[model samples]
Target: MSIPAIDLMTTLRSGHSTSPRLTWYGPDSERVELSGRVLDNWVAKTSNLLQDELDAEPGMRLGLALPAHWKSVIWALAAWQLGMETVLDGGDADYLVTDRPDSSGRHDAVIAVALPALAMRWPGELPAGSIDYASEVRSHGDVFMAHTDPSASVCAIRAHDGQQHLHEGLLTGFAAPHEDGVRLLVAAADGLEAALSNSLGAWSSGGSVLLAHPDVELTDKLLAAERIHGK
Candidate 1:
């Protein structure tokens, strides 16, 4: 099913914000406020661009190379505001460019993401049929806004075919709100404890989630993630 077009600012004003919701943990310092301001600006700019795409197609899916940084959280939220799907990948996953795997029954435009510097290894390319996140969003200019609604949902999980499965869903059910009756497909990635905790929290609190693990196989994905990424 397709999502509905929404005014992100209006959505936040109305109580159904789609901007990504993030909880950055850092030592108490001055940079926190400074970083928050910069982040808010970036999110504001990204939100408008995504909102336009979502306005055009509520069911649009986006491939996201989720960097292990605070900014990644904001970028994911912007996509949610537009009601678009977000496919998560490793920071270096962009290297999968030539080998972008074809998993979803649908197609996606990959972006060459500029990830934050970290010790973790990055994905070399995007999936089989995706675009470069960095190239796509690099030149896009939009200052962010602080006051935005960040209530939409997006997440990623590993699929059976060695591909990623991204999922999205409505924040409110039309007939039965939060009844597990409606689930939006979203991005895919190795299961991260923190990410799942956040996604599940949203699902239970009447917010959208990135995936639905009604089957046992889905749990295996989490195990695999732990095996690979768990230090």
Candidate 2:
């Protein structure tokens, strides 16, 4: 059976490969934009790193102990594409992706992610056993091929509230509603779950998302510059 998340990515890649799919406005006057093809490339590389290096597979639990940033979004998408279950809470997991390496000792594997767009590697030394995501991810393949296909009924996400969402209903049941082709603005302050839900809704409808960091003021000029249609 085809995974809904992977299918959505395929549609995004084929439909408008050059159009901006995700735009990020972060602290320190940082701005990053990713077109559909570029977004897929990042997801593919991350998926490859998870699947090949960490032996990730369907049914494996991948915990994300990170905030609602672009890197976190990519990690979720990568986990889904590899058929791994994404744990939003600090639950038990086979692998944990986090910015804080100190608290990730319990997981079997740890991936330390850097939030800066231009970071070539983690700023400081990570935990002895943790992998540096920014450093290693770039070396992986730009395309990913899953070793096994996941069933539609397989668990896709484990929410912070302990609700389990299946692959078949991930987007249909959880995504926030928006009009077709709506350029939605997602506030990172709303949390990771909301970011994922809104992004799914926007992309699934041939739309795009603009993610603003908590510190970035949502000014009228910024909204106009980004052509935001809804929040």
Q: Please list all clashing residue pairs in model 2, or write none if there are none.
A: none
Residues 1-231, candidate 1: write the lDDT tens digits. 322213322333234333333333222211111122344445555665454332323334555444333445455555554444444443322122212344443333333344432213235754454544444443445553323333334333332234443333333321123333223222223333234334334433434433322232334564353222221
How many residue pairs collide in each prediction? 47, 0
Q: List the candidate 2 regions with Cα displacement exceeding 4 Å.
A: none
Using TM-score as the measure, the top candidate is 2
Candidate 2 lDDT tens digits, 1-231 = 688889988987889699999999999999999999999999999999998999888889999989999999999999988778898878789999998887436888999998899999999878789999989999999888898887778899966676788988888976778789989999999999999999999998899999999999888888999997445
The true-versus-predicted C-alpha distance at residue 67 of model 2, in Å, is 0.6
Cα lDDT for residue 144, model 2? Answer: 84
Point out where model 1 deviates above 4 Å. Answer: 1-37, 49-56, 65-68, 88-108, 117-193, 196-231
